[model samples]
Target chain A: MRFIDDFRNAEHVKALAGSIERRAAQAGRPLRFMEVCGGHTMAIHRFGLPQLLPESVELLSGPGCPVCVTPTTYIDRAIELGRDGALLTTFGDLYRVPGSERSVEGASAAGLLEALVVYSPRDALRAAQDSHDREVVFLAIGFETTAPTVAATLLEAKRLGLRNFRVLSGHKTMPRALRALLEAPEVAIDGFILPGHVCTITGARPFTFIPDEFGVPCCVTGFEPADILASIEKLTELCGPGRRPALENAYRRAVRPDGNEKALALLERVMVPVDAQWRGIGHIPGSGLDLGPQWLEFRVEPPDPERPSAEYSACRCGDVLRGLIKPAECSLFGEVCTPDSPVGPCMVSSEGSCAAHFKYGSQTFTAGLAEIAENGKGY
Target chain B: MTEKTIKLGHGSGGSLTRALIEETLLRYFDSPLLAGLPDSAKVQLQGVPAAFTTDTYVVDPLFFPGGDIGKLAVYGTVNDLAVVGAIPRFISCALIIEEGLPQSDLRTILSSMRQAADHAGTEVVTGDTKVVPRGKADSIFINTAGIGAFRPESALPDAEMKAGDVVLVSGPIGDHGAAVLSAREGLNLDSAILSDCAPVTEVAQAILAGARRTSFLRDVTRGGLVTILNEAVGGAPLGLLLREQDIPVRPGVRSICELLGLDPFYLACEGRVAAVIDAESAPIVVEAVRRTPAGQDATIIGEATAEYAGEIVIETAFGTHRLVQMLSGEQLPRIC
Candidate 1:
């Protein structure tokens, strides 16, 4: 509660909003910043941070949600493992993620397979240890924030000599994906609100490329409202026409400049970067993580390639992830594709841009926002 | 195509479960009493007005901090009857025990059930038990059907809701959910947070006694406060605007929700009651509820609104409105 309550203090948030408004006035230009973390996206919408920002400042969500950006092919592979009688275990976020034909949850619902939602990789390891007769496949899907734990779990599995334990990994790195978003012609991002959780592992250096290469201001941000507002305030100050681009660590309390060395070492030992397929974005070099040579035996891959892939031709999730369009810009966002029956991964994952927008951003009370800002009390 | 079968989400008390009852179950059982779909069905037994309800408990882990499944089974049914303005009198319990369950554990659960019934001032009149193979069931499952006599001038209907009505919640939300989840996952959250799995009969009775016009009353169980409100507003040309800061959530529960990236509003509460009272008697009802120990934390969370008909929205701490949709699928832990 220390960090949460203090950070969400209405007085502090109002002060930061005042500072951001002043900075926005001084900049005299539209501030288009992309929040490159799904946590940031969710916090922005959940806390209604957009309403606090000045009219000139706009925040766009990037490919931040790990479950949303995961290619359906990986989900297909995990579902296939479940169908092959493997007791599949995965993060709860991936349990309902549609995988081409169906999800692991759908398979379990149909009585075709067994799947469990585990909070961490260690739980999946425990499941494997508990079930001796059935093969337990951990569907590993996440960004750097989760990769170290998966690496440690894999090492533990090897140490225990568990023959039934395996992992279907869809782990991905962030810096490369951020670069891909920048290189696109349609996206015109001026600054970035970096993912604080990932930076706690990979550190601030990995994201310096955004400023050095593309002249975009970057701020590693936390999930709290004040943390995000402070990051936006800093980004606003640095994004003025005459100002030079810079990388600021707004979430220095949690993240270090160099990151967690022990976790990085674990990732280096057990995992290797590979060209991976993203859901909306195409394959990116060295973006995905796969088991290293020593850990190959613990890996699970799709048995066949000619399986059904996701039918997402109508879903503008790609545009939404790239900051090219809002979720409402898509035809199937709220009507046909909703949280109940999601048509794409964006609508499925709570952290996905579309889902966040749909869940919290679809409606706003104009009177409430103006009234609160005027009184300086309601917030 | 995969054949449809029951999924875990169907038991989550969210939209899927709502659909299961409204779309599938209702189609087969074509009775007006069942069609109303209140927590308890209104009925007349031998020329006396009565309320009847049934619920099944299959909570995993059987035991948790503050309360276990047995206490939950009894309190859940009794609360259902109490919310419908009924004084619970009799309850029928059925147990499905799995083989290999320890006798000591069974005795402990059974004793807890008896104690809970005693505390609620209800009697377990009839019961049944069956044993299944070791893998057929999780430790034990309990189902309970309750019957209560409706007091004269105590029938609260859903349509009684209107704009300007006050919504009050009895104590904090998400305690039971956060307690159970942290206990199951070994999250070691602040130990002060415990399951609020007590009977809401006292709180409900307080509202009925004090408020001149109590429009709606529901024990916030599965799907948390938001889901219950959505159900409360079903097909009614009314909206609810809840002040996010006004809703009571314990610090420990809020911390756990923050850690898991889950919304506390969507978390379940086994003992909390959400009620709508007429605008004139709202303050009187709150004062009356606060006099009771169980309702000490009771306060006005929101009010029914004419704007955004057929919807519920929460005004965030920043004073921006966010549409509160029914719990879709399940509130799963996020993959950070």
Candidate 2:
């Protein structure tokens, strides 16, 4: 009980909450803050951190969730495999996501799905070997933190000569998304709460450009409230009066500025950069990873595309991802688009700024947070 | 239409997607629930309801072992309202479709949603739809808002937990999350693994028959039963205890989690709940669930303690004690 309770030093959060309010009050201006990890989005929502903060301090979501940013084509390809009797495997979080008109779960219910919700690609390889009679297609989706595991899976699959397996990859890099996000027209982001897991894999080099080029402060923090508070303090220091943007690491317990060399090495060996489309953000150059030509044997063709009879309009999700508008401000927020029938990418992913705000009431304290964090889902 | 490779626009809510929804969606889920042309539905509530419950589903791969998004949505909303002793009546489905998606698949998914709604005895009633540019959306995303009827005598309180109560689960723990994880993560265990995403209204009503002995009831969603248990027992004068062996887990789920270095307790569960019953009526309450289809797999997993008020502990297989914390973020693909 003590160990379980130790993880939550709620009292510290309470104290920090008071201090943050005091600091924001003294500044008398709306304080802008962004939590750059999808996990943080969920944590803040789950813990109701937005409710805990003062009206002047605005907490915004950034482009963080890999699942949220992954393009529909990758999912459609995975869904196609599921429809074709191929045993499609992926993270469980993807199972409920609707592909076009339905999700992998809906696809499975109709006898057109072989989607398995997996924890790692290593498990996918093992499944391929076990189900020797059927093809196990791994739907690889993640940022750099998870790509190495896919690499290891492929190496092991080849080592064992598993002939009944293939992969549909949409693994992406983090730096590109961050750069694109900074240029989005939705909100004027003052600072960033960099992802801790991605940093553990790619290191600080990928993010240094943010501060150097954009003049915005970025802090890498752990999931704990203390870690988040410490990161916030670091942001205030870098962005305060006469302060310039900079990169600071608050998660020193695990993340090193240099990152894991061996993981990066594996990534370079197995994959290469490809022009990828994010679910909300448009085509970001060199933002995604694809299997090297040598690794083509690991990939199989995906499902057929269902082209819209007419040109589709801008979903507004792109604007939302870039912090363009509040979910309610959107034409199709709660009125026409609930999670059951999401119309844009922002509502599709739980970590998406619009979806997070819609699911949990985060707009209550956001008013006094003027010009600081203006948009919930900006383009 | 000749078979061709799928493009991202299929999910977009344009002409092609409309074809899928109209042609295929109307075929199965042709009911009033999914027929709505608005973002959200406005219902009369049929005479002033006391509580409002909204839930959203964003499972990846969208489809997995047992059920797909269609059934998951229906059951998810039904279970959400049912946990509070409400019989889910009216519901709405909101969809976000990625552009360049296929029509054939949409038809398939809509049909499945209809089937799930039929099984759960709920109506779709109203829904919304939107289309994003090709890269602006995933295949599809569904959010469900359900309004239901809760009997005045059977209201489930948010913070009504008390001490000396017994905790009961409808069925095996972690199977739904683990099954999904195995299929998604590709752990590939020899054992068959399927998600437990059934509607539990029947079982819930059975428990409510003796609701007087119950202090609090909550569905084990998102963060799972440990999360609910932690929240239920915490800030109260009682502690909860569970015998690890008493918590049922399937062979494939255990193997998948063990192989992946994950724990089964933190995974999501769609068709289960943790009901705190008076210690004397625990067995009778368990029997009530045993008689129902959804609760046939139910078991008494833990009990509340007077000591260490507001903490959950599990007696491990090693005869040692360890505390169970609420899931921090998401257990991700580990669900069975």
Candidate 3:
């Protein structure tokens, strides 16, 4: 609480916000920026960053929320295993995310499956070791930042030779998603505020493509609003519609290009790139990582479509993921798709745009989103 | 190592001191009066009876994320009374000061305590102070008690939660835990992740105002919501059903929880509150709690019923279901 208290000098945030607004006016006609870290998305939402920013400078959330991007079939697969009588294990966020007709929480609450919510992969591995009778499957979902842990887990499982232990690998690579965002014709992003955590793992090199090929200003930023503003300044100042890639480290306090080599190496040994299926975006060709042959025992497959499933057809989560609309833009947003009764994956994940827009983005958050969706255009 | 034997310091009026009371003595001996024990003993009088309790905080890092020992001590007692249907009125304060704590830091903490107390609409009533040798204690330990007017419940262990009784949480989980984790370890992300450490009596009072057929109410602390769901109905006939997507957790908290390998369900949240009420009243109470700042993110996490015959299970996001058992050991120590 003390550390936060020190940071709460709100005047500083105001000063920073003012500076950003001022800087944006002189910088150009309009500036577009996106934060790749889910944490940054949350912080921006928590602090009301959008409302404070100048009208010309737009803050759009990218594919930062992991649960939002998680395909529905994966959840169905997880639910299937839970129904097939395996003890499902995952972080709490994954527990609430719906696959098709239900979530792991529903299965656990309904007594159809055993959901072991754990704090770490160590705990999942420990559960696999301690409970010989139960089938423990770790529902792995994250970016390259968290990819190494799964590597460590699989290697540990291999060492322990725990037969009951498996990982439903829904884990993704950050760079791939970023590339998909840039390549999309519908999206016209001017600058990128790269992910801090993911960069810490893959390093700034992975983002070199955004600068070299796409010619978009790429600045790896810290989580703070000031950090974001500072990164935005670098991005806008450096980004002059040129056909050259630029690599910048706005979060220099922590990130380096090579990143944690040990972590990267650990991931390299245990995993390899494979064609992954995105829920709303469809398959983005090698956008996901699959366990290597040695780790096949821990492999996960897409869930069966035949199982009992439920979905509120009106949820426009597909639009939200592709940067076509915000969460409130969905017709079912707060009415049918409140946090309690999520209609789509974005609504299901707490960090999703729908959740953010619904929870904090507006006096009536959905109004702006609906208008944007109605316009059928991207900024 | 069973944490069986108690030391002399266990009675030292610090956090571990209370842990001794809760973990060792209270575990084997919990009754209405004993269970009701808070910062101070409450004796009901005619006009407006109030509940009160005091706790001494000795967390290793005196302050982290959203609040500190002083703020936690204030909100803890206030929330305890509020959960039991009381309007927190005033609080008594005392400090067991470590001999060499910086005066400025102490002033800062005291000011924060005042601000938090003021924010909660409770005034500091009476107090005491004690100083000990430097190594004798952590940097600082705050002991505070709050009193609140008890609403005329006019009920008992009454109408035990039915099979369809809904379980509700005041707001998102793991704010305090993630905030503390980041602050304690100096893990910098893009933005500041602060603790959700504050009182919720005003919101709790609102939920209680709209009386419904309720069996029990408890704030998920120490063990998180998972622990509360496990203990909701002591009897063998009660069943607790939870829809995974219904539960809310801040995305950052979830990601950090994933990164650190922690469970937000088991993570500590000072501002989050939970209660077992009639299924119909959950949304009503959620709406009521939403009126307060702390309860803005309130949601109905699950329901309690006479189904499982006596166990807690959570469905995974992947669609499978499993049991959510009580934490046998500490997940993250000194996170309050």
Candidate 4:
């Protein structure tokens, strides 16, 4: 906890918060910063950072939760394979996410599929190795932080000549997604709080475009409270009057300018970028990673295209993910959708914007607001 | 549609397990004692009140750092009795052994149980054993039923907690959970982590002695500290406000939790107890607990409140408040 505890110091956090408040006041205008990682979103809520921020500064949660961004098509295909006698293995977060008709957990509960929750891609590989007769499909999800491990697993499967092992990848890259967010005309984001873990693998170079092309100051920040406060202060300074937008690494302890060379090489060797369909935002060109030609045989694709996909018609998860609306604005938010019985991906993934808001924000903020109204004081 | 079947979540002791109990088992066993749903049931035997509790051990990898399944069975039952302000006296153990289990393994397990019971100052006086087909069961499973004399002056009911009660945990959270997980995953965290799997009878006794009136006392077992608090506040006009920074989690356990994408609040602690006492008596209770071996790390973690009645919330280290809901299912690792 050496490195972690240092960034979570209460004294340092208070100092950073004071500086951020002063800087925001000096800017003399509303500023909106978007954090483009589910981890960052969770951290902001977990630390209750929003309450500490100046009223004029708004933080938008981007479409960064991999499970939330993964379209229903991927889950449907995975379920179909699961029902067809394949031993489906997936990360825990994906198990509860609803597909077109049913979630993998619902399918497993109903005895249609034999799904297993695994800690790593290697666990899936071990399952495939253990059960030689059944095909094992690992649901590959997440951004750069997870892609390299899946790539290495595929290489190991090849080295072992394991024919039963396969992957249904909905893997996405962070840079293109960030670029897509920037290209949106409706969003008025002033700066970006980049993902630290993702940057640890892909480096800060991929995010330099945000500052250079969009004139949006970007800071690769860690997840701790002080790290986030420090990053916000840095972004405020960068976006100050007469200051040029630049990409900075606030999480220099973990991330570097060039990133992890070995992880990048592994990902490049095993996968290629493709046009992937995001749940709310439609298709983002070259945002998705698919298996390369060498690993194509291990890819599991949907068996049918004509099948009608089930939709949660009343859910406003797409709008929520895009920061077009808050989770409270969704009609079905706490009533029809909850963590126990989530109607959409946003409520299913632990890091999903809706889940974070519902779990941490809605009730607490409302109660705090009521207290403030009664006492004429701010918390 | 797939046919419904049993899953691992059923045994996780979280919301899912509670649902299973309410939907299936509770219907058939609707006695007043069972309905109370205390860790141990109070029974009147010939006009004298006694505590009766039963628990089954089904932990994977029978042997783990600090303790094994047999030790856990003994300590788990003894702790359950102790938390209810009972002087644990006797226990009955029932063993279900698979056909192919080695004699040496069985001997080791039995000896461990004997040592644990002796350490707790309790006697496993009566026992039964049964053998099953090789594939019918795991290597071994032990079920223990304990009987203890109730300390009438110190008895703390499960629903006795009130607003302004201070919550204190006997030691660091998640050590037992992390240790077990490490042993299962072969993570080599054994160098830094060890299971806090022991009886906390002495700590419970000291807490009862120090507090003028003990509102609640529960061993943080399967469902962990948060789950226990959630259960304690369920349907009651009470709320628990815990301080995240005040919660003592071992550095090794914290690292393991980070590695597994788990919250230590929901991790099981076999040896730890979560108690609620009146605000005025909190200082005395903490002093008394700190003097005991099992409670040396004890600290006041939170206080009960009327705000957000029937809810559990935590003031995070960042000075923000967040609701701590009972975990719905198993804590599985995330891809990220």
Task: Please give me the DockQ of candidate 4 compared with the native complex.
Answer: 0.57
Superposed Cα deviation of residue A97, candidate 3 (Å): 0.9
Cα displacement (Å) at residue A149, model 4: 1.3
Candidate 2 chain A: worst-modelled 10 consecutive residues by lDDT = A303-312
lDDT of each: 0.86, 0.70, 0.70, 0.85
Candidate 4 docking band: medium
lDDT of 3 by residue, B1-336 (tens): 112333322432323445566777788887566673433345566755656666666665778877887788888777777776667789888988889889998898888888888988889989888899988978888888778775565332224677777777888887887888787656787667787888887667766665477666666666677766655644457767676668887778876775564667778778877777787767777788888888887778777655444656454332334445444334421100
| A310 Cα displacement, candidate 2 (Å) | 11
User: B8, model 3: CA deviation in Å?
Assistant: 38
* Ranking of predictions according to DockQ: 1, 4, 2, 3
Residue B153 of model 3, lDDT score: 54
Q: What digit string (tens of lDDT, one per residue) describes model 1 on residues B33-114? A: 9876889998987788899999999987788888999999999999999999888889998999999999999999989999
Q: Which clashing pairs does model 4 show?
A: A110-B2, A110-B3
CAPRI tier for the interface of model 3: incorrect
Docking class of 1: medium
- How do all models score by TM-score? 0.95, 0.57, 0.57, 0.94
Badly placed stretches (over 4 Å) of model 3 are A1-12, A239-245, A302-312, A362-379, B1-336
lDDT value, residue B233 of candidate 4: 80
**Compared with the true structure, what per-residue lDDT tens digits does model 4 show for residues A130-235?**
9997899999988999999999999999999999999998898889987887788887788889998999999999999998899899899888888888889999
Tens-digit lDDT track for model 2 on A135-239? 899888788888888888888888888889898877778899888888765568778889888899888878999899988888998765567777776776675
lDDT of 4 by residue, B49-143 (tens): 99999999988889888889999999999999999889899999999999999999999999999999999989999999999999899999899
Candidate 2 chain B: worst 10 consecutive residues by lDDT?
Answer: B1-10
Among the numbered candidates, top TM-score falls to 1
